[model samples]
Target: MRVFTVLGPSQAGKSTLVRAMAGLDKEAGQKLEAAGVVTLQPFSFMGEDWGAIEVAGGAENLAQAGPALAASDAAVVCVPADAEAAVLSAPYLRKVEEAGLPVFLFINRMDQTRDRVADVLAGLQTYCAHHLVLRQVPMREGGQVVGAVDLISERAWSYQDGKPSALVELPDGVRPREVEARGELLEALADFDDQLMEELIEDQEILVKEIYDVATRTLQHSQLIPVFLGAAEHCNGVMRLMKSLRHEAPPVEQALARLSPGGRVVAVGCMGELVKHLGKSVLLRAMNADCSSGTEMAGQAIGGLTMVAKGGNGSLAMGDLGRVVKSDHLRLGQVYLKDGARALPDWAQPRPATYRRLVTPVHQRDEARLSTALERMGEIDPAMEVTQDEATGHALLNLQGPQHLRRVIQTLKAEFGVEVTEDMVPPALRETITKPVEIHHRHRKQSGGAGQFADVVIAIKPLPRGSGVTFDDCVKGGAVPRNYIPSVEAGAREALMQGTNGHPVVDVAITLKDGKHHSVDSSDYAFRMAGKAAVREALGEAGLVLLQPIVKVAIHVPSVFSGNLVPMVSGMKGQILGFEAEQDAAGWDLFETLLPMAAQDELCSALASATRGTAWFQSGFDHYEEARRGDFGAK
Candidate 1:
């Protein structure tokens, strides 16, 4: 059996196409409850069994498609018939190109669009690295697509509901268009085949087999992408698409060679993990060798193997995806070889997290359970991350966007039974003094027999940015005992934890100018209290300012949407640094700017809305700058 992955934007009919190919339901698009999850379906076409791995189509879920693509024989990219929808395919196309896999573009919902195939191809060409060739030209009647003329075979077929297309005579009105598209397809094939080029130049008749051979070779080499038109909902043109895949898609051995350079036996690709009722099951794709019960993988024996469509499989053959149960040693994105296990070289890393929320269990006693559930969720979806906020000591759930975070929260409640509440992550704010001030304090506590007596005078001064708190002993003639000086410094450092603004004080220096200590009553506790009280009095005298964290962000989007970025950034009170055209990515631009950490979530949401979810940004901590106290409600 051969395996191929179907990917596209959400609601582009990817799941519907997969279901149609499997002969399950032609109307599956209407009942798409599991649209954000990866599913595997099996089907038989022309006596050859095949598997289709349908990946989540949302832009936020693109990270899940990497492992699926890496482990498959080829990729079938399903895109809507609308021309503007082509931009949404950019990221998926890049992934398939990087994996060096043969890719096919299926123009779904052809019956619903009036746009010509030429215009759609032109829009997609801007993003694809490979030359796209139209394999079939749509045959429309009354402005509705009813059939397609195959460019390779020059045969015409009329679509039928819930069945294979019926053969039809070539209509005269469609002949000219068919000839033009066939010519273009031949020309594209000629670029990679010298013989075909000569035949085309000499105007000689080309055999169907000759065209197929050229198309197959060029496609496997990633030189050209063949486009097919179809309305998967009506089961129209699906069989034709399947026939093309069966003949033109690369074999399992060829896919293995592309994944691993040399021909090595016993290679298994771990696509992902599925948490089942029995236990955790590792989704495995056999790239080279057949895997069965007791097959040694990643230094662990596979207790059992189960197929996605068929249960209790005896053995998983090459190019087939199955689940391995009762095994805890396998990991996602890892390729198991005879020598050792290693990560898939072309596996995509998860995008940078932009949205964050502080998550806590509803019940305090379930904190441990929540932590365990989050750890498992991280393994299931690498795009979601769990981290600790240094300033507040809260567990922050970092995700690609709002939708990604919501899915995680839902999973925590439904799957793990760990109900939780979420809140916005607090900004890590800092406080600093504006000027220097001198203060004196005496911590005298006369309680019963032993009295606590200590005195100290300290001067506090503001320091430059990024210069953390500093302590200096400027006492003359040891007026304050040397042994007791360390305690006073410790107490002063602790006092800076909460300043007048209720934030940690930074960029300040304190000096021990003078102090009096009794030989019998000058204990560390007495001096510590004196130091704490002195610093409190000094901070009150000196004014405090709040500093907000600033981040340097790099935003990438199609150049067509570049104009919308400036205003969006300005609305967030950000400063634009500069921008330039992205290298190697045509029609795309990269912009750099400085933005406040508090507005990162808003920026992400705004970009998604403005760019139709085609824009993404990465940010890092730059520095801390003084901010308006009113912004944070600081007193």
Candidate 2:
């Protein structure tokens, strides 16, 4: 079976086309939401089984498609013919290209569009890395597309609304355009095949099988995209699209060859609610052989096996998607072989979450339930991360975007019965000494049986930012006992946890210069108290300074907004390093700067609004700097 995923921008008619391909009603299923993955019934293509999965076009949902693209044997990118051909599916196209999967473009809703096919194809070429060769050209009637001509077979078809196209002779009006498109398709395929190039150069006739072979190889290597046209609402041109998939898409063995060899079974998706008796449902993609119930997959018994398509059941052959149960060692996007597990490359890893929201139970009494609910949610949506902020002790849900976060929140409330509200994350700060200070302190207790007594002298100095807390013992003449000295250092370190500024102390060094300990009266406890007292005295004398955490941030936006960055970062007390053209993304600039953590919330929200949701930024902890008097509501 061949697994093909449909990816496109929102409302591109992706789901409808997928349903038509599977012989289902176009309007039968619910509209797709963020992270929605729908599997259609298995259908035969050239007498071989094939399954199709549709991925919704929401920006946040595209992150989830990366894993599916990596898992599938091929992909179909959908674009609406009626809308401006802005290549809104660029992100998905890039991901599919990176995965080295065979991909084809479906120009859907053609019956509603009046745009010239040449103009639409030109716009798509800007976003696609490789050439998009037109495999089929639209046939127009009464100034609208009524059918399409196949470039490969030199065949034309006239549409019968709500039914398969009826084959017809090449139209006299479209003959010249068909010949030109066929030549272009052959030229693109020839670039990848030396023999084909020689034949084309020699003006020799080429067999359809030879052209198809070259096209299949070119597509499998991601060197070209074959374009198909259709209005899935009327099921027009759907059969030809499936035929192209059947002939051009590579087999499962060849597709899985790019992945590590050890994995006989690989699972692309992680969420399924089947096989309750086996504890959890596990979806597995076969790479080498067929599987059945009670089959031991990767040393775990498959208590049950179910097919992905509707009414499809029984043993799963190579390249089929099915649900397995009773597997204890299974994980998301993992490859399991009889010997060991195979890891996916870095690109296959889920994208880092760009949006963060602090969450807490509305009633504060369902914290535990919230934790469990988040864990289950994470299990279901691997792209969405749920973690606790160490500094603020707040529950933070890091997701791809606001839409993805909203879906997770909705699931938490509706499925888990846990109501939560977004909360403000507190600013995290550090404390350090501004100047060095020397202090002497005595810890004497005369109200006890042994009457404790100890005297300690120490010097405190500030280190460079990020140096953290350091301790050195420079005692002389046994002034401080070796065994008692450890306790003294421990007490001093403990005191630094909450400095005079009520924050963790950092970048300070303490030296034990001299101290006196009575062998009979003074013990570890007394010396510890003396050390703590000495540190406190030094802190007061030296005066503590509040330091704010600075982050190294890189903001990527369309070049049009490059001028807005300086003022934007400066407004948040940020220091700009520089900016340059972003190499990975064309027509975009990358601005590098240092920003305080307190300003991150405003920056994230503002950037999206300013760039019309085209710009984004990522940050990492850089160092700590002295906070300005008025920064971050500081006193």
Candidate 3:
């Protein structure tokens, strides 16, 4: 039994489709009588059949049902003929693509369109490029979508009011145009079957088994995305889609190809050996195995999982076919790094670097627990480094990007109960003298314990950019005792590491040309104190400038929306880099530019809302530059 996600825009007739496929009445059972929420209306077929699974609708309901929706195995993307509905439907499709989930798209309400099935098929050719593959040619009756001819099985099912009617031979309307469409889908599937291609080129009818096997492999590799016809409102063409899924959905063995090159189909590994994360309750994670080559799903046992809850996402143990699930939503999969992918035994892959100046913890008191739990996260993804930042107390966890962050955070809360809080860290600033200065300092003290005295004359000069700080022992005849020289160096280094603006100081050379030390009373401690005194005096007289961080951001927005976003970024102190036109990848213009880091916060949500969540972007830290001199905020 394969799990498939049913994704589409809100009210694209997904609920109605589920009812029709489940053999339930749309008007009466549309709400799924047993289940209060109609979103995840699981329709289980024959008690013994490795049946087809249908789950949930998209939109307000979909977002709230995230945990349940992600648990699906494959997806059925529904696109209504309505323009606004289709435009909003892209987000759901993009998510399925991002998850690498195998999906079959249903072009709903095709009977409402002006053109016939052939024109729609031709236009869909360039719609998603390689991401889409049409599997069934839409069957038309009197200008209405009455049924579909399965390109793979060559089986046609004519429907009336949502039910499959008597089976018929391939119809005349699709004969000429489908000769090419069906051949194309089969040809793409042929790489998985040489004999299938041979029979096709020779003009010989290919057997159903050959076509099914090839199509399964193609769907598993995401090379062919089947498009079916449906009109849930009218109860049209739903049952035919259901029957096709029973024979079409790829077996577990084929889908594993995405995880690795063909490896041996081994026996399923034993459970309980894995380290299950303990939250309020224990949560187990398991991996999928190649069970298609005759492994009986009935042989698997659900031992020791005695206390079953009302509902939970994990193993789907129905007699023999046992599958591991991570979330209630079937679109998501278990996150894993290929073995031996990173250097550190704990590190699974090279973690991505972090350019954010400050990282705020997402929840309170989460620093310690999150650190312990995420140590393995860095191992699986070498690009991450999880720890605490001493300066700001931020749980400094570096990651690849926003997607990686979302996944980790979800797993942490749902699996570990680590409520995190974020405290954004402000970027470090630099203060360098705009002009050179010479300074002198003297200290004298007399007390009952002992008399103490020290004096120094130092010149601080700004070096060419990149010429680091340097100090010379120019005192004549031990003007400053050898024992005290290190102390002076220590004091100067500390001052440089912490500048007047509470940032690191750079690009300066200090010369200790003259200094006197009391032979009896002078110590390294006194000299160290004097060096600290000298730097403070020198920097005060030397004019200084503050440097700020710069970052590069690529924004995707419609051309009409760019007119608004461009000025928004500019107002945030960004420099417009350039722009280019694109198609589906970026609905409109791709805006690329460099901007200050301080302006980036909340930009993601802003962009998403601006484009109704259609836009995407890549932002990176570039370098540091002097901030524009003026009032910090409103004058």
Candidate 4:
């Protein structure tokens, strides 16, 4: 059996195409409505069994598709017929190329479009690293694409509603177009074949079997991409696509060589864990060898194997996916061998979290339950991060985007039975002193038995940004006891934790100039009190300023939309560093900038709107800079 993953943007008919190929057209509509994760289905075509893994699409869910992509033998990229949707396939195409997986570009929903196939291919070619060769030319009737003429076989077919297309005579009007497309396909193949190049130059007729061999070889090597057209909703061109995959897609052994070199047994964890009535089943794919009950992989015995297909009979075979019901040690994206486990080098990694929100249990008593559920959620979706603020001690959930957050919240309530409230994350503001000041203070306590007395004079000075707090003792002649001087420094550092504006103080230095201590009443506690009081008084006279976190950002978008990013960044009070055309990704731009941390979410939203959800960015903490009082509503 062979495995292929279906990937594309959300609402691009990826699930519909999978169902169509699986001979489940009736369930296609129903499945699409609830499909938001990777789903596996098995089917046989032309006496060969195959598995179709449909990866959830969209920017929010793309990171979650990593495991499926890592384990598949080939990729079937479903693309909408519209030219505008071509850019949406950039990230997926990049991933496929990186994996070196053979790809079949299925331009779905062809029946609903009047655009030329060449136009759609042109748009997609800009983002694809491999040469795109159209395998079929649209056969239109009455201004509608009724079917397509296969360039290789020189056969024509008319699509039937929800059934296999009927073979028809080649139309005279389409013959010229088909010939030109076939020539283009041959030309692409000729680039890598001297014989084919010579044959084409000499006007020699090329054999169909030779063309097939070249197509398969080039595709497996990730040098050429074959394009097919269809509307999977009506089963148009579905059979043809399947037949092509059955012949051109690489086999299990080839995939093993490419994915796990020199390994005879390899299994990759996929989709995390699936909770069943029996137990928690870890979804995995057999990449090199068959696995069954009692099989030892990575030193853990496989309790049982349940194949993810109709009437599978609970057996796992090479190139197929199944559930390992008894393994407790496996994790998503882990590659297990007969003796040990290793990471899949080609596995896709989730993007960094850009949006965050504070989460709290509604009843306050389910805090522990929420924590456990979030841990489980993390195991399922590694892209999400759960953290706590050290200052505020508030639990926060970081996610890919707003949509990802919503889905996570929904899962928490529906699956984990944890109802939680969410709020905006508070800014991590800080304070810094403006100048130097000196102050003196005396600590005195009068009790019936013992009295405390201590005196200290300290100087506070501003330092450069990011310098943090520094402590120095300039006292001479033991004016302050050596043991008590350490206490004074400790107290001063603790006092800096909360400045006059209720934020941590940074980038300042404290010096203990002189102090007096009594022989009996003076103690660490007394000296500490004096140090705290003196530092507080000095800060009051030195003046304070608010500092907000700034982040370095790299924004990726199509070159056409690069102009919009300038105004977008400026609107958020960000500084643009530079921008240049991205290497290897034609027609795309990478913009580097410095943006305020508080505006990160807004930037994501704006880029999505300006680029039609085709933009993505990464950011990390840069440094703290002075913030305007009005910007943060701080007095």
**Residue 323 accuracy (lDDT) in model 3:** 29
Superposed by TM-score, candidate 3 places the C-alpha of residue 152 at a distance from the truth, in angstroms, of 4.8
- For each candidate, what TM-score against the reference? 0.90, 0.88, 0.66, 0.94
lDDT of 3 by residue, 1-635 (tens): 44455657655677666656666322222221201122333344543222222333422223222222233346687777554444465556545554465677887776676566555554444334344556667776666666667776677766666445547888777787577877777777775678877887898977777777776666666666777776776666666566566666655544334333343222221111113452111121122442222223223322222212123323333212232322121111122222211111111122223323234336657656676666544322333456666656666765533544555666566555675544455555555666777767776677767666667777788876546678866778878877777787787677777666776777788877778988766767677778878877888788666666677888755554666677667777789998886554423578898977766655554665666654556678777666676613211
Off by over 4 Å in 4: 24-35, 273-279, 310-314, 338-340
lDDT of 2 by residue, 465-505 (tens): 88988898999889998888887898788778888768888
Candidate 1 residues 1-635, lDDT tens each?
Answer: 78898998888899889888877333111111222567767666666667787888776878777667777788999999988888887777766776778999999999899998899989888887788999999898999888999999999999887778889999999999999989989998999999999999999989999999999999888899999999999988888888888888988888788667875635554354435365556677787778888887777677778765355677877876677767766666567776567776744566677788998889998899988887766655666779987866668988887777787877777777888888898888998999999999998998788889889999999999889999998888878989999989988998999998788999999998999998888899999999999999999989988998899999988777888999999988899998998886766789899998999989888998888888788999988889965677855
Off by over 4 Å in 2: 24-41, 44-47, 82-87, 140-143, 166-176, 266-279, 309-313, 326-328, 358-373, 392-396, 554-591, 602-618
Local distance difference test values of all predictions, in order:
0.82, 0.76, 0.54, 0.82
Which TM-score value belongs to model 2?
Answer: 0.88
lDDT of 2: 0.76
Off by over 4 Å in 3: 5-43, 47-102, 108-131, 137-213, 231-238, 255-257, 260-391, 394-428, 451-453, 461-477, 496-513, 554-571, 576-592, 609-611, 630-635
Q: Candidate 3 vs. truth: CA RMSD?
A: 8.0
In terms of TM-score, which candidate is stronger, 1 or 2? 1
Off by over 4 Å in 1: 24-36, 262-276, 337-341, 441-457, 474-486, 513-528
